[model samples]
Target: MPDFSFDRLRRHPDVEAENLFAVDASDRLILDEAAADLAAAGPGEVVVLEDHYGALTLGAAALHGARGIRTHQDGLSGEQALARNAAESGLAEAYRSLPLGEELLAGARVVLLQLPRSLSALDELADAVRRFASPHVRVFAGGRIKHMTIAMNEVLGRHFGELQVSPARQKSRVLIASAPLPVTDAPAWPRVARHDDLAPGLSLTVCAHGAAFAGTTIDIGTRFLLEFLDRMKPDAGSAIDLGCGTGVLAAALARRRPGLRLIATDQSAAAVASARATMEANGVTDRVRVVRDDALGSRPDASAELIVLNPPFHIGSSVHAGIALKLFEDAARVLRPGGELWTVWNTHLGYRPALTRIVGPTHQVARNAKFTVTVSTR
Candidate 1:
């Protein structure tokens, strides 16, 4: 049996909390179920997708001696954590990160996957595999049974002819699929949606990739934040949409203040892509710049005149505040003196105290039953 030690694993570079962990039962189940296929595959033939913090990648390399493993992770934190974990575990060069397309999936055999919760993400992955992978490739997709749905099977079935469900173990189950089916055409993504009710004559085009938060629609927190757009300093030369999911905030800012240069940044590759598309769709591509980065780490200290955020309350699936706090700290570092950080968060998170300590003096902008919007002056 391979050494599957959770005690030795860590979520370094990803948000960590008392209750959050790097590996899960599903990770082990996927690896265990795909052991035979993984062992038989030659170098560069095995592909791993969404391997949280190197568990699937490192485990495959270290335990099964699987080499030249090509892997893809949507989040920057997860990618960084995987690198750190690989180095710490003496498997630094075992796997390389690649985009989810022809290059990553143009393989000879087996794939170990951690099924994404988003059905759209699943559709994208399945489409890519069917379009790129070898005809005989077998995919072992596993997840917690509680998180699985019939839709996942249907999504896989659309691309693969054969599907087999593995017996549940440790509350996890793996879906094995093979025989790639040909598709006449690939589906269009970065789907667009229009928000006409935000403001009179202010119909906005929102775009989103499958993995983007809230998809193409504006979430309540963001919609609430947008209500106060008129309150932002008009003359501010540059503004940042920190943790921008689909560039909605940045696009709105650009649309409202054509003179302002807006930076839209998020850690998720999918989010960044969606944000860029949103900017383009809304005719703000020239004014809004979309980037994939860890919080505001890519910006220079004291560089931004204004930063707006609708921070996430969770790290992966866990309801933890570490991620929001980290973003708050980054916003603090990036905002200039006299600049402002406008934030919207779940009211229960009670981020005002942390905002005061991290950014500067804070004042409540708006609050309702669910969310609180606060502005912190630096």
Candidate 2:
């Protein structure tokens, strides 16, 4: 489990009630000396948060008495962690949080950002901040040692203002803006109403804030599954798309069939945000529910009619088959006698045998050059 311990940090004299919320954050102040800088911040200030790189928000909460801050991310885990960090620590109700595509980010004098993993997300944020910030607004951004480079500085400098680095402190540094003015240019990427045509009336519009396997034009494995999913004709009942990045499969399947009550689940806040955005864009916001979850956690109900998954091969940099196997086992526990399960994976991972153990019978609908969509009948 990810550490939720903030027992030590809370004891510090300078930490504010809002700052206490950093407890659940993925930010690592344990090793870094940014704590000194955090101890220095004061009241009613606004800041912008970078994606998964969370020092700024936590720092702002800790030292600055940060108020009215704006934080956005395309990663579902990132946003969830931020919220968890805040809520579990008693700061969530106090801080202002918004997803990437939401409006109402205008009017701020200070912007704190972390360079995003997606260049598109990065560009979009920079452009958005530049448009909204006051002329003399101060833009500060940071990253760990590995990501700080001339290219990063160039990206920051071009979009916001003249950039300068703080003295290296514990393998991390803050990027301070020299001068910044409101950018007059319109954003290069705007949220569109329609993208690819999955069907005549089913135009797919993206949540532009998409990152990783969720956004890069759909995963090959998922596409393969989507193409052949109808062969099984999933029964009517509550269904879940476990690890539903952007909720693509869950949303698509639910839209195709009305009886399937679906919930899309993922641990990433960025993914959750995108899934929500996609849900809104596709006008299925009322039809499907989205959850910030881990491997389906423990299902409250004993039976789910259909469980569809395009299980991930890795999380962050860790690759282990244990979680996927656990999800399959959980599926068996929650599935009714006539329920069904569907999954697609890369060709070589050998998922069918284990899946068969849980669902009773299994077979492939179609095998593309890179993936195979499998159906397991209970």
Candidate 3:
């Protein structure tokens, strides 16, 4: 093994804190378990999925002499972190980033995956591998033991004929699967569903790719926030759906105000794809533009008149307020003076003070049993 250093990895462009880390034991264990396959594989044979940083891809390249790695990361932040780490480590040429499709999986012989928490995501990835990757491909999927469940094995088994469980090391474990099953059915991802009861006389068709948050269903926080949609700045010519997952809010807004220009943006590639599909399903494609961005990073400062948000309270599995606070600061920077930021969050998060400090003059809009909706004006 080469003397490669995982310690050099950092979660830049994502939330960084004492508890959050770019690399984890699961990453190390995945690399360790897949070392022989990576070393024996030919060029363009290794693929990494949902790598939190460049750890797995870089580790395979630097430590095992693997080359031509193709990787897919759902979060734009993760992709950015991996790119930065790859460049800094001088392994930028070893791998290329691609979407989760046939181009990324075709002819792949070895796949190292940091198992996603969502079974739907794993199912989609496994199905893609079965349908597109080489028949001899071996998938080494690992995650923290606490997050891994028996259902993950069941999900992978649906696509692969063989499944092997590795012994736990450092509270992490890897599941080895091979022998891709024949795929006869059409791809099941980007699932669509109709919600007629979001509001009276308001029906929404939500579409979600496998990795999208809430997955074709509306979360309580967003549902609470939507209650006050009519009360939003009525005269505002344009509006933004910050962190718009599935574009539910943006579609509703576009329907409510036919003349208002709308933008729906999220960092997750899956979310962006799903939101675009949702917008199209609702016949709002021309009125609402979907973008994959990191917390309105592409928006100009003081450019937005109204923004609707249901910011995530957790970064990865670790519950942290940093991600929400980062969005708050970005929303503040993007909102013009007197612009409104309507937000809904868990009652326990207590984001009012932060909103007041970051945006300005935060006022409670509504409160349900578990959620609190607030409108902050800049």
Candidate 4:
């Protein structure tokens, strides 16, 4: 992957509001010059739409500090990435990410967007933009010049009056846009209670904004985890829901064991926020603490008795298993002796040996047509 972060930081340490929203595979870093420009913007607030890989969200935090919004495609790590960016940038005090796809815009002052990979998503975003944009909204769109396709500008033009491209520098360009017009809102996509028939007492209703794997419904992997969940005999005494994307697993855990204090942690701000909303839908938010911690970065020593996961194998399109391996270590570090670690994974990922190596002992818990679930005891 290209190091967009290093490139931006190297070339433009001097620009203001260098805050950015990114695609799933961005390589952005905080540039000192850009940081200084942000200080010049003073204390003004900015909005970041579609947080892919978390580059723009980090920039916004670096620039505005404590005033940021990150919308994530539905998944767990995207929630976790916001935390990682906040930690590496030392901007935790100034950064907060909203789960992407939720109803947002509580009077946003400015909008910063990284053109999404999908032009269809761009159409959806244009409608989202108009909700917060009046004639007064200042919008800046950033990406590599190659990413700024004509369809991309058409979406912006459809929502805002016009788009003027900034001179290409270091192979990247910015689209400066303003003036809101009457743009037809896209029909809301159906999102709540994916795949299952309505169960009067066991149904889950989510406020879904499409994006992420299974953004529109329950994902197959998640469905496997839910099926494996022994609702009647849920382990208690503190559980950690790893990669709590949209909080489905955490919510199910909460619903199954009302007394459990589950910690919802993921790499994506969207996942964290989704987890929070999922718990809230069940009236169990008070029982869970929604944390924006990377895998368990903020977890105290020996803090959890049960750790649940549907481990992710990649960071964007880059296949790096290091994150999951590191998270296994982190989970073991935070679990009490002999604490249980439960997981459901795609059968081909060769996850068992890794589980055994990390947690000391592993046992096959269950299996379905396409997946195998395991419980590792530390």
Candidate whose TM-score is highest: 3
For model 3, the superposed segments whose C-alpha errors exceed 4 Å read 1-4
Per-candidate TM-scores read: 0.96, 0.68, 0.98, 0.66
Per-residue lDDT tens digits for candidate 2, residues 157-263, read 67755766676656666666646545566555534344464543444665634343446366667666766445445556577888787677877776677666788
How many backbone clashes can be found in candidate 2?
Answer: 13
Q: Each candidate's lDDT (Cα)?
A: 0.88, 0.61, 0.94, 0.61
Per-residue lDDT of model 3, residues 186-250, tens digit only: 99989999998887668899999999999999988888877787899988999999999899999
C-alpha RMSD values across all candidates:
1.9, 6.9, 1.2, 7.7
How accurate locally is residue 252 in candidate 1, as Cα lDDT from 0 to 100?
Answer: 88
lDDT string, candidate 1, 145-193, tens digits? 9889999999999989999999999999999999989868856676899
Best by lDDT: 3
Deviation from native of the Cα of residue 72 in model 3, angstroms:
0.2
lDDT of 1 at 100: 74
lDDT of candidate 1 at residue 348, scale 0 to 100: 88
* Alpha-carbon lDDT of model 4: 0.61
lDDT of 3 at 20: 91
The residue ranges of model 1 lying beyond 4 angstroms of the native Cα positions read: 1-6
